[model samples]
Target: MSEMFQTYERQYQELVSGLKQGCVAAGALNEDQRRPKVPELKTALDEGDSLIRRMDLEARGLQPPQKTAFLGKLKNYKAELTNLKREVKMMSMGAGAREQLLEGGQFTTSQEQRVQLAAATDRMYQTGDRIREGKKVLVETEELGVSILQDLHRQREVLQHSKNTLHGVDDNIARGKVIIHNISRRITRNKYIMAGLIIFLLLAILVIATGKRHQG
Candidate 1:
């Protein structure tokens, strides 16, 4: 269990790092959802989540199979983060108080109130509650890290089987892309060949006609 906690602690630290980066990146994204840059930022954020999920798997010693599930969850979280970031940005723009719809009133910018509530939530609140959902997620992520280590201890063979399945799918997709690219190249080559042959035949006919006219 000590090993598990160690793994969990490492993963937690990595997640905190990612969260800090995410906050900074969130500021780089457009404040308005209507902007074209918003989608680009969203895509970047989604890709970031993918990186984080893969990193988490490496941290947990879970290997590969679970990576897909975590990736799926990461994608979901990316969507959530995008929405949250967009809302937060909108709030920054002096929009109305009800963008989030989480609580009845608009969120106040009183840094003291925000700090005190945050402290209270950290100290006395159940991590699972809606008010402290982020904390709950962090704790659960640690539990997942421990669970993954234990799983590796007991059911590694089964986990590897899952890993193989996912890897197979990933390989097939890569192979499919290569095949499609080759087919496209072949079709283009054939088109050029056909065009070249048509031009050659036309030139030959013209030469023969000129010789016959000269002989006449």
Candidate 2:
């Protein structure tokens, strides 16, 4: 994508250079010679316009960061194209005026040309407006996507914390079981000791009573 952008950038620069050269060359020519140059300049301008639109579309398709990076350059290209249009318009007007002067004000072709140029300029402005709106939408969408990813990240953290808490609880339960088992063993041993003591006392009492009866 970067390479493609660079390629477009290079082409646009070349086109602009050629256009400027053409404008200069036309300016140095006689009206008759410059007459043919206007159409050629208009063709270059059209090609540049199309190329810029293509660049805009390509920029739109890029990632947010990449799009951001290209924005300045894109704006610069747009400015350049606008300047080229103005130059072409001025050249056309100059030629038309010279022809009208030479023909004693009988040139209606320039008026029609002006109207067409105005319409084309209006369309260019409308296209620019649409491109701006599209950029706004794209920014909003990128922000929404970032927000969603953050929410997902937070939820993942919560889930991981819950799993760790459950593991701790399991550990505590296992410890409790071991403690209860040890206590139960201690209680059984104590009961056995008490039984042995009781048996010893009973045997002593029997022996004493038997001896007493023999003496009597």
Candidate 3:
């Protein structure tokens, strides 16, 4: 929660507490004594109403999920304010009418039970909000894990392709080495054959020259 929202909430709680105290005090007093306190209770009620409106405005400014989380609290506050207003109205009533409505303390007990129920409901809503937040985090983490796996798969495919390309280059290099070795052997054999033919031609020429000399 924002600091401003916290401040508003604190003020609202104070108003609620003050209103409850005023109602209880007024209940104990006689008609004349309660008359003066009625205006004070009404003023606190108005302030509480205004604070709730402001708190609601703040809630509306929140993101949808957070706003939803705050709705239950806001609703509880409104209900409490309504109850306070009813109490103030009763205080403003004549003694006879007030006694008839509040006879046997049943109404006060019921009101206290409603307040407790509202508090419990607020706690339940908060718990639900926390659960939703945890679920959202888990979902994001799962998506991240999936994305990492996909990236690793792509990298593995690239590495495999590169390995294949290297193997093809190695095969071509091996073939080229064999062809060079064969060409070198063929050139050496042709040189030996040429040398033998030159030697035979010279020997034949010498023999013919000696025979000519003998005939002369």
Candidate 4:
């Protein structure tokens, strides 16, 4: 069980690290490169989703709270990926359409293109917001993990103390048994000595009485 738990933990950590790295890479891109980076972001998100599902299925024995939190994280990651994909596709289509509308050297206003552009821009901003929120979530999760570790440590200490106390009690009980046995043996020996002394005294009294009779 411990081995399985360790394996699960290692996979979880690796997945989280990959996600954080992907986010950092996304955040570091310049404006000109963001659209191109969308493909990479989607790939990362897809991999995350795949891993999450596998973990969910394999680690079905997870406690309810952990499973709930895991599912929540997966949902957030999946949603962000979908939003980014939509934004990228919209922007790309708008760009292509605008080029085609640049007919006869007159590239003027197109309402549909404008609408798509606006929507794309909104989604872009939303994605940025989500990225920041993801960072916050990661930080909070790390703190929570630390707290859990501390609690485990405290519980281990308590168990160790209890074990020591039990050992001491066992040792004391053994000593008490030995002492009682010795006391019982001594009492038995004293009984035998006491009987012998009484017998000797009776013999002496009888001998004295017989001597007195002879003298009379």
Candidate 5:
């Protein structure tokens, strides 16, 4: 029973850590940053959940799983996971809000909303230029339309790459700060230890000198 409990706790912690990473990845995606590791994160989350479930079954004869500490934590983790899943959904939505203009009643993330606006602009431009010329306009516009869509897609790709680079820089800066902080802490501790050692050495010398004088 104790061993099963230990396994459940370890699985639970792993799940929590994975969820945190997923949540960060989701947030980074919200910034239109590409997250290529989302699939692996999903796998980790699934594996963690499965491990907990397996442990639950294993402890059936030895203990009551429901009343165990693991269940309580698992429930909390589920709630956190629910919120994280919503964040992930919103990240994909890209544009989300109340808009009567949407033929489909749904919210989209801000990025999708921008893309929708761009599409609307394209449609409007095509409608206005339709009467200017016949075949030339049709051919020119067709090529131009394809070109515009391609450019937009390419621009988004570039922006996502830039965002990812920026995120990397930010993470590096954060890690640097932690490293500096840890170094400072260690230096301070070393200073205190050295001072204590020096004081002890001085006291020992004084004690030996006093003993010699008393002997004299």
Candidate 6:
């Protein structure tokens, strides 16, 4: 059980690390795109993807009971990773579409390409807003995760202490049973010895009384 719990702890830490890294990477990607930062954005994206995959694989290897809770946390982190990926995709696509519309030399208001560009920009803005909200949520979840980890630590400590205490109680019960058995045996031996002594005394008195009657 301790081994299982350790496995869970390792997995939990990985998931938390993944969540924080992914959020940070997502923000970096957005900042890069906004400021025309190159290669660094791509580098950050690659690193984030690798970390996310590693954490996911680790999470999948966890065993039962602890696995249930571990998996739940992994799922939540996976969702966050997916959101980050989607946000990146949308931003990249929107940028490409905007560039294409500008290069086509068609500035007409009703042009199909123009409309698509507008729609893409709107999506980009929405994605940005969503990422902002997600960052806030991630911040709040970080605090919550810390509190939860602390709670788990304290709770496990209590459980171990309780288990040790119960083991002591079990040992005491077995010892008490043996002691009681010995005491009962001694009581039985005393009763038999006393009964035999009483019987011998009564027989001797009866014999003496018969002799006295014959003599008188």
- Which candidate leads in TM-score? 2
> What is the C-alpha local distance difference test score of candidate 5?
0.63
**Poorly placed runs, candidate 5 (over 4 Å):** 1-133
Write the number of the candidate with greater lDDT, choosing between 5 and 6.
5
Ranking by TM-score: 2, 3, 4, 5, 6, 1
Q: Each prediction's Cα lDDT score?
A: 0.56, 0.77, 0.77, 0.63, 0.63, 0.62
| TM per candidate | 0.27, 0.49, 0.48, 0.45, 0.38, 0.36
Q: What TM-score does candidate 5 reach?
A: 0.38
Clashing residue pairs for model 6: none
Best-fitting candidate, measured by lDDT? Answer: 2
Model 6 vs. true fold: TM: 0.36
Candidate 5's residue-wise lDDT over 1-216, tens digit each?
667667767777777676777768666653435333443444455555455554554444345644566566656766765665565444434234323336565556974676676467446535533533354445456656865787799999999999999999999999999999999999999999999999999999999999999999
C-alpha displacement of 112 in model 2, angstroms? 1.7
RMSD (CA, Å), candidate 4 to true, equals 11.7
**Candidate 3 residue-wise lDDT, 19-124, digit = tens:** 8988998999986577667766776776786677667766866788878877678899999999988988876655464455556566667666654654564466
**Which prediction has more favorable TM-score, 3 or 4?**
3
Please provide, for model 2 over 129-190, each residue's C-alpha lDDT reduced to its tens digit, 9 standing for 90 to 100.
Answer: 57655765675576568667877999999999999999999999999999999999999999
RMSD of each: 25.8, 9.7, 17.3, 11.7, 28.1, 12.0
RMSD of 3: 17.3
lDDT tens digits, residues 73-191, model 6?
65775676566566545444445656677788767766776567557656765676576557556755765686578779999999999999999999999999999999999999999
Tens digit of per-residue lDDT, candidate 4, span 65-89: 7667665655664565565556445
Q: Over the stretch 60-113, how does candidate 1's per-residue lDDT look in tens digits?
A: 454456645554555555566566556535534422322333344654577447
Counted clashes in each candidate structure: 0, 0, 0, 0, 8, 0
Task: Tell me the lDDT of model 3 at 160.
Answer: 100
